[model samples]
Target: MISLGGKPLDIAAFEQIVLHQKDINISATAIKEVTRSYQFLQSFSKDKLIYGINTGFGPMAQYRIDDNDRKELQYNLIRSHSSGMGQLLSPLHTRALMLSRLNTMLLGYSGIHPETVQLITDLINNEAYPCVYAHGGVGASGDLVQLAHLALGLIGEGEFWFEGSIQKADKVFKKLKLKPLSIHIREGLAILNGTSAMNGIGGVNVIMAHRLVIWSTLLSLMINEMMEAYDDHFSVELNGVKRHNGQQQIASWMRAFGDKSKLLRKRHEYLYDKKVTEDVLVDKVQEYYSLRCVPQILGPIYDTVLNTEKVIIDEINSVNDNPIIDRKNKNIFHGGNFHGDYVALEMDKLKIAVTKLSMLADRQLNFILNPALNGKLPPFANAGRLGLNFGIQGMQYPATSTVAENQSLSTPMYIHSIPNNNDNQDIVSMGCNAAVMCSRVIDNAYEVLAVELIALVQAIDIRGISSKLSPATKWLYNGARSIFPYFKEDFAPSQKMREVKNWLTETDITGHFHKQL
Candidate 1:
């Protein structure tokens, strides 16, 4: 179980709750703080005009609301904004959204009632996900529309995903023996006015992108082994001269991966130790840039992913709602804490980094498929009779096209803001769009990597070098072959490709090399 409120939540613990379905325990201190904040807000706002408690939201804040209709006002805010339209977020992402919102409230600055916290906790533990959408949030003023749908579900009015199907919120609540969240003061605005939606999606993207990098690294090493490429490029002596931490770390991993391999060659052992040879050497002196410059290429991607992780973790632990309710300081300050620029910028950088990784995988796939380039392996690595049968040729089309699509989608969403909400949200952040697009890019990269993996194993089998592979490469080869056995005849590869993709998504190959990032 993951513990909240006592210590700040990090990415690892967040992953445990979202990906592993671990239950969360709210701290006693956090519960007391939530109660204290609620009481303070109730007493302090009785005679004062607060942002959402008394006045209207956004441009309507100039209007005054009477005490009699204040509860209805919060309800109106939730009901009016429950206008999200598009595909429903998967249960995984919806659960992450709930967790992100919950963590922020647990900071005890949102002035939310203790019951709100308990209800959200129950929903998460019971795996009843709100039916949030993909297109409703512009991410300025914090995923307003998408989170309003979440708020709608909390009030037991909208649809929810339970037991692998959509059910009405009231029915799900009844079956779970739970009560809907009652609007005490500002639960509606509090739920809608935060960066949780984008933060949650971006958090999952970071986890998957980190895995994508490790998979690309392993695939790069395997390709080098297939070609018997020179080891000097990833050698410590060569990469240490570069002043990048990512470069050095990637080089270290490559060295470790090739430690016991019989296929990797030392340049000096063949060239320097030997006497004068033929004027025209048959071996190519250096490899293509994709094979030789892996450390340089993937180093920036590694650094970007790490930086993105830090920013996302920071956002999740923050109080992102407006009108900070500081019970300790006995004050309420209004501002734009709900803006999502931090998460937006990080998501843009992350998608670009992942897109580059996919480009590398595509290039390596091309190198192995063309005999003119690698000087080995038949066209498309076809193991059957030449020209009579095709091997993995059709898979390359989707891989290349998918990489092209990722390149197009990598256009930054950070600067694409359009003023809306009656210009009240001028200069807004399109953070949710960025997070969603980044998710698509990560998903596309996985497909591309899956195709590359299939090609790598096929090349290994064609070369008859299974015995010479490193232990790490052999593990991958064996695992992949088990999923997609050796094929020499022409057949449709769509299903086989998906099986490999699913395996890549579900398997945690990073742990075999080092601790997960």
Candidate 2:
């Protein structure tokens, strides 16, 4: 059970609630807060009231909603606002949003009844999520349209994703033996009026970005092995001079990941001096820059991941509803908790880091594909002239496209906003849009890592035919081989790349001896 007393929602509990399908429970105090907020709304009929409860919303606020019809008014708000234009958000995202909205309302500040919170909670603990569209939230007036669909489902008016189809809410509620919530004044406004979609998406992203950081570090390890970069670059003294925390972390990781002899041997021997014959040229330089500079390039990405985590954790705990009930102070105030600037900027920053990470993976994959970079391992593209050439050629186009799409999608969404709610909302938060864009960036990054997995395996396979490669390379190589065996001839690799990406999700690399997880 997670408490929601104007504190950040617990994201790990949410993950278990959805991924593991856990039960839900609300605190007694949370139920009281919602009751107090509801009572406060009921007490203020004669005073100049808020537009959402007794008056019309947005441009229509000039017209007052009648007391007898307040319940209908809230339902109408939800029905009208369910005007989302795009496809539905994925089931994972929809479930996350449902839980987020429930947790947000538990702060007891949204003037909703305890039953309302319980109703939403019932859907979640019962493995039910209201079907919400992918678009229609600007993030300023609290994800408006997207959230409207969620509210619509709660009131038995809209549809829900059940089994495989979008079923009418009433039918599903009955079929699943669930109780439908009775409409209350301003319940729709409160439910659909916060940054839940943006927050939900941001929560998932925190996990995805964290995974990408691990994958990028592992990819960097693969490149480092192929490049034979100077272990001295990872030396404690070299990084301590700058005192960059992330740099120090990267260096430490490199030190742990490098050849065991590199740490023990007092004298570093150049392969050129020891092994290279008179046939080589250009100093037979130690691996390309892509492989050599991973710590320098991706160390900052590690720091960005850390910052993104802080943003999500802070947002999760904060009460994001308008018209918060300060029952402790006996004050009812409506303000700007609906604003999504906080989540949008964090997602934009995450996208930027993830974009660079995918590009880095693609570059490393490129080096592994080339024999010159692989160094006496395999031919360019690593297919090894099956008949003549095949595997590498087909895979290259997809890798290139993934990198380009990531670059294009990383353009920040926070800087752009369109006024909505009839100028009442003149400035908006593009937080929901940021979530969508960031999700796309992650999809693109997944494919990039997939291709890198193929290339890393190939580089190791050819190198290993003679002498065993670094222990780290073998770990990654064997891991990839389990899911994606070496391709000696032409074949479709889309399936293989996907397998590698999924492996990273469940496999804990920190448990392994090698750094290339």
Candidate 3:
């Protein structure tokens, strides 16, 4: 079990917990801090006018709530705000959502009861994933409605997904012998008022983005070697002069892949290697931009994914709820820590980075499908009678369409805020939308990469030189070929591409290479 407390939580461990369903617990010090903060908040009276305590929320803050109705007010707040609608988030996103929110409360400033904190932890430990909806989170005031839906499940009032089926929260709670959570004053607002939803989505996106970068580098190296492109573009002498760390790293990775190749040839020595049966013609003095600029294009994507990961890590460890309780100083501060602008901007950047990577894959796919540019390979890598069967000719359509869709989805969401909550939130951040868009872009990029990998592998087979492929490329080629049997017919490749997408996401592509190396 991973214990969360005063120390920093790494994203790797966080991923293990959320994606792998590892158990987690609040640290001892965090439990104490939660109790202290809750006791301090409990000391407040009905007339004290703390935000979301005895006073109303948003534009309704002017209305005062009586002591007897404070609990009802908090309960009603959750009931009304649990208004999210749309397709539900996947179980992984929902699990991350709970973990992010729990991490926020564990900071000991949200004034949430320790029991409620444990309740959330228990939900995660039990693998009880609430069905958080996609819509209703403007990301201005902490994803109010989306988180409220999460809170609704905690109180045994909404639905949850358990054992691959949707069931009522009450029934699941009863079966698990877990009591329904009670919402005291300020607890409802604390739970619903934060960037947990966006952070959760952002967290998953960051992981996927990281994978995409690695896959992009691997595929680029594979394509480069397959085309027998000049290795000077990724040479240390050229990239080292730029003083760019990302470039240096990608160049080094390319060298590792290229070092094992028999196909990588110097420009001047095309006939020296005796392994050649056919003299591959050198048509151009220099490779095209897509083939030559892998490091340059992927360098920024690496930096962007890392930068976004840092932002999301900090957001996960922060106390983003309103009315932060200063237990030591006996003071309260009400501010918009709940604002998701930080994650919003980073997610937008991630979408763009992943989209560009997808475009690179699309460009490579286009190049390899054209006989003129593909080192004399058949058009679309077709080996059969050209008119009787089309090999990968039709597969390019999905890659092109996804690239176009990703281009449209890359528009930033931070600049398009509309006023809501009676102008209390005059300028909002559509962070949730940015995160969702990032997720879609990542998925699209995966499919594009899958298609590119399939097409490249087919090209390698068409060349009829399995011995010429580098060990690293051969490993990837074998791994992918295992899942997606080499295409032999003209049927649509959609089903095969989908299966490959799943395999790529689950199989640690780069990690496998590292282990083999």
lDDT of 2 by residue, 331-440 (tens): 76768888999899989988998899888888877777666655655554455565476656577778888899889899999989888677888988799999989988
Q: What does candidate 2 score on TM?
A: 0.90
lDDT of 3 at 159: 93
Location of the lowest summed lDDT over 10 successive residues in candidate 3: 270-279
The candidate with the higher lDDT, 2 or 3, is 3
Q: What is candidate 2's local distance difference test score?
A: 0.74
lDDT of each: 0.92, 0.74, 0.86
Give per-model TM-scores: 0.98, 0.90, 0.95
**lDDT tens readout by residue for model 3, 1-517:** 9998778778988888987789988899989999988888788532477778878999999898887888888899899999988899988899999989998888888888788888888888888887889999899899998899988998888899887888899888988899888876577888899999999999999988888888888889888878777788899899999887877888888888777798776754754444446555445657888999999999988989989999999999988988788788888998999999999999999999999999999999999899877666888888777878888888889999999999999999999899988899999889998998899999999999998999989888887765787877787788789877766677767888898888878776545666432
lDDT of 1 by residue, 4-107 (tens): 89678998898889988999879999998888989999998888989999899899999999999899999999999999887888899999999999999998
Query: In candidate 1, which residue ranges exceed 4 Å CA deviation?
Result: 515-517
- Model 2, residue pairs in steric clash: 7-317, 8-316, 8-317, 8-318, 9-316, 9-317, 369-381
Q: What TM-score would candidate 3 get against the native?
A: 0.95
Candidate 3 residue-wise lDDT at 347: 96
Q: What ranking emerges by lDDT with the best candidate at the front?
A: 1, 3, 2
The parts of candidate 2 lying over 4 Å away from their true place are 1-8, 45-48, 257-286, 381-387, 465-473, 505-517
lDDT of 3: 0.86
Strongest candidate by TM-score: 1
